[model samples]
Target: MALTGSLDAAAQAKAAKAEAYKAPRTAFGQPDLSGYWTNNTMTPMTRRPGVSSLVYTEDEVKKMEAEAEAEVEEGNAPTDPNAGAEAAKPAASSLRPEFAAAGGDVGGYNRGWLDPGHTVMRVRGEPRSSLITTPNGQIPPRKKGAPPPPGFGRGLGSFDSYETRSLGERCIIGFGRNGGPPMFPNGFYNNNYQFIQTPDHFVIEVEMNHDLRIVRLNAKHRTDDVRPYFGDSIGWWEGDTLVVETTHIPQSQGFMGSWKDLKVTERFTRVGPQRVHYAFTIDDPTVWDAPWGGEYEFAPLNGRIFEYACHEGNYALPGILAGARAEEQAAAEAAAAKAAEAAKSKAKDKKAGD
Candidate 1:
């Protein structure tokens, strides 16, 4: 009887603690969201094949972490310069077979430069396989035979002009959706973000390419013709959550081919002292048959954001144009030489006949 009474008292105490918890507020009486945060995780946007569940069992999580540690060890292994060419081939199980070839020479950077988080994403004390919460754990399929919307710099055909390259390659926006209306982790380094909130505005400063997203508070979106890179975002406080609605996204800066009439709704709520719950929904009738959404949590980081400085040292543009010019000149010379040879053969044949 005494043990039962003790258990009841403990349960009541836990309930009381939960009731006493409250979110911290800003000086202006808004939920404080001003801090440096990181959304880096090993959790993929879609569930891996053969994984039947969204949440992993404790044993499954342990095995996953162990595999990750082994991968990290293999990646950090010292490369032997004297190794033979035959020894450099990629294993069949490698995630990126192209990078594994030639001792990673073809790939831009070594494994040391990559920092796609080591562990799976933990939300509400459970390790999740994917951030996407749909029944299939994947982004909704696009409409049948739906072509990608036309926009500037959409394809890479010729390097005759700078506009042919992607916006991210041109250093105009963050690459791989690092700076987004529905921001996601880049799966590489520089996955940090800094949030600054004011009475009239909220800013999300992305670490990659140093992209900044300025969201107006309690305001309407800009005119439709004035599309921005990350879209025109307007926010309002709903209880402890900051609700953001974004529209007028530039077609060139569309996410997953959902640009035309795309609408993104995001909610940010401080669920714990060090954690912020983030959820976003993608709505575009022209692209997907139905709206799809994902949820994830952001954890506070210790350091401040630093400048990315990408364009200042970029030399690829001039190099690409120069290579194209050389190829064009060579093709023209070959054609001219072939025509001259044909004319000379005709003259020689006429002289022989006379």
Candidate 2:
């Protein structure tokens, strides 16, 4: 009886402390993370299976942070993947997770270039396995071996070349996991985001491709004909949380060959003065099994999202095609030369036999 009393008192006290730390609200009493916010934590795209669903103990979070710092330190010192076999063990394959499966073998950026951080922010104190809450943090397998997002095909001429390329290689959108059908975070820099709020609307601006998602608060849903880049989004205030449902995503802006039918529902709540808890649920029957969801705590960035001028007609496209054509041409000429040499040898052998 005495032990139970003590436990109840401790629980009440913890709850009281949490309530005290909760940020004071706006004039309308909405928690405000309206400033520039970024989540730079290095939590991987998929959760490690053995990890617990609950937040990490303080000691564990610290250990993970320390490991991340060590990785950064090692990356600062350049090491070659082609170094002696023993030295090369440090450079393991980057293509382990399903995250890399969609991106078939585009190579040569070092681990040093990646800013994926080590410890995720403990929002309300839970250390996350991934932002994903679903069993096995993944986007579910692609159906029927849908060919991975199309790569730049070899071009026959000028017009046929640039128009048919990948969005990222042409410098139009962020590559791989950057400019998402559902806007996934990536290894590259500029993972920052900013939220601007008015009474009637909320705008989320992701730094990749300068993708801006506009949510009409307390507004009517779009009709079926109204397709959009990031899809048409509508928001409503559900208690203190802002729930935004998005649909009608254009095929051009999707991942895993599923933009047309993709549906993303996101919730934003100002949990702390500096941190906005961002959670999203992705639902595309064509792409995922059930509605897989994830959450990440956004840390405050000091400034606004800078310009991301991802232009289309860059020299990179031309360069890539030119490089491919040159290799093909060289191979063709070599084959012809080898055939001619074989014919001459055959003629000499026939004459000697005669």
Give the winner by TM-score: 1
What digit string (tens of lDDT, one per residue) describes model 2 on residues 53-75? 43455687788788767766755
Could you tell me every candidate's TM-score relative to the true structure?
A: 0.85, 0.70
Give the TM-score comparing model 2 with the true structure, all chains together: 0.70
- Whole-model lDDT values for every prediction: 0.77, 0.64
Residue-level lDDT tens digits of model 1 in 6-43 = 22354456435533557788899888989999998778
Give me candidate 1's TM-score against the actual structure. Answer: 0.85
Worst 10 residues of 2 by lDDT: 1-10
The lDDT leader among the candidates is 1
Q: Worst 10-residue stretch by lDDT in candidate 1?
A: 1-10
